[model samples]
Target: MGRPKQFDPDVAVERAMDVFWRKGYAATSPQDLVDAIGIGKGSLYNAFGSKHALFERALRRYRDDQGAVLVELLERPGPVRERLREVLELLVAMDLADSDRRGCMAVNAAAEVAADDPAAAELVRRMLDRTEGAFRALIERGQRAGEIAADRDAAALGSLLVNTVVGLRLMVRVAEGPERLERVIDAVVDSV
Candidate 1:
């Protein structure tokens, strides 16, 4: 309809996501988005409605794109213990290799706006729910496969692991190296 959108929506959103990811919602200006995404002001407005809408789409994209790995890993048909270990190892690697130390866009959004904005809070809540659900399924699978203690509550354990990941992501934002993460991984896995 409108010139068929000159750029790829995915690529443009990815670029916009990087801008928002680097700078939080309040700080990321429309001009910044224009500069980063190479999209004109009118086109951006027409395509995305507003900055907040664009952010929501980008955040959803992030979870759907980057977070798919977690969902897939959790769903894998394997011993629960090994799957959990794999999840933690992947988490650790993500923390260590994060060049920008962006500390997870979802977590960052949660910290930045969960208390103030209803829309943002809802987004944060959904992200948390999805993450915890993945963990719950993994834990349940472990219990079913005789890998995890049967007495343990999968929902609670999953919530705990989600919290651990949030904490670990936050810690990596300030910590210089992986020493703290190694200790954390050991503690989390050993407990499970």
Candidate 2:
């Protein structure tokens, strides 16, 4: 009865992720998704429910992938400041590598839809929460080990770092230079 599914769902979602990453959710239509994902309208709906659902899935995937990388990077043996620098460095690298200049899918979504749509907003919120949590934990460990200032509140520092990170992603869209980003990273580490 139904046409056999040709595209791998994960691959399709990754493609959709790129499209949505480039164009915010409000600007992206179902036709855009169909074209980008190479799946028919009927199949797209049947497989992923709707554009909103697909976006949710894609954002989740992005979060999981980024989270895994951040965990590994933070886990590796290095000074906390170096770990922080490496994290920002990696982000700059990704931004520079992308020819299309897609800043960040999650950050873009957070900017565009986080205030209007509940589900979409929640996804973005969760992403920020996870990022803040990671930074907070790292800061806590750094303080305990005398790697950072013990007087600094890791919670506040974590929030600040999360904001800085998202700002870095947004900044990449308009400005890009390794030296510039490294300077910002230095300032962030100094503040911590």
Candidate 3:
């Protein structure tokens, strides 16, 4: 019989998520994952199969944890515009506050490996789709509440907001100050 394994796979995946978030898929070495997860290289492969496999798991973990937070924030009780601003502002703050300047992991993965890797691309696409749907729901709520014009297209606006968020996250990595992000937030929320 095979030897019983040690270390929790869930915790290992969480640690791997952190590593992949900090270092893009191509840049992170297997040793990096082993060191981050506090496991031997053999154990890491035995548990996750390979670096790419581990990365896929890590990306999914990121989706279930960090990615879901945005939807939760959007779903909070408040005016749609106010909630949108709050969620967008919070995301900008988080990205700016990170000392490592690592932007959204899904966005980074999409930029790094999604072109050549179908699995990574699907994961990123699913995240974008989910976020867009949340934004659409919020917009519909606003329209029903008479906060937003009824004639406007909620679905299109949702896509625009998701694009805005993607831009905001990428901008956080290079922004020298919060001024740019603030302007962006103001412009997008006001437009919505």
Highest TM-score: give the candidate number.
Answer: 3
| Candidate 2 lDDT tens digits, 1-67 | 9667688999989998888888888899999999998888999999999999999999989888887
| Each prediction's TM-score versus the true structure | 0.92, 0.92, 0.96
Residue pairs whose backbone atoms clash in candidate 2: none
TM-score of 1: 0.92
Error of 1 at 162 (Å): 0.7
lDDT by residue for model 1 (81-185), tens: 678777877876786787888888888888887788778778777878898999998888888878889999999999999999889888888887888887887
Specify the poorest-scoring 10-residue window by lDDT in model 3: 2-11
Model 2 RMSD in angstroms: 1.8
- RMSD versus native structure for model 1: 2.4
- What is the full ranking by lDDT, best candidate first? 3, 2, 1
State residue 181's C-alpha deviation in candidate 1, in Å. 1.2
Residue pairs whose backbone atoms clash in candidate 3: none
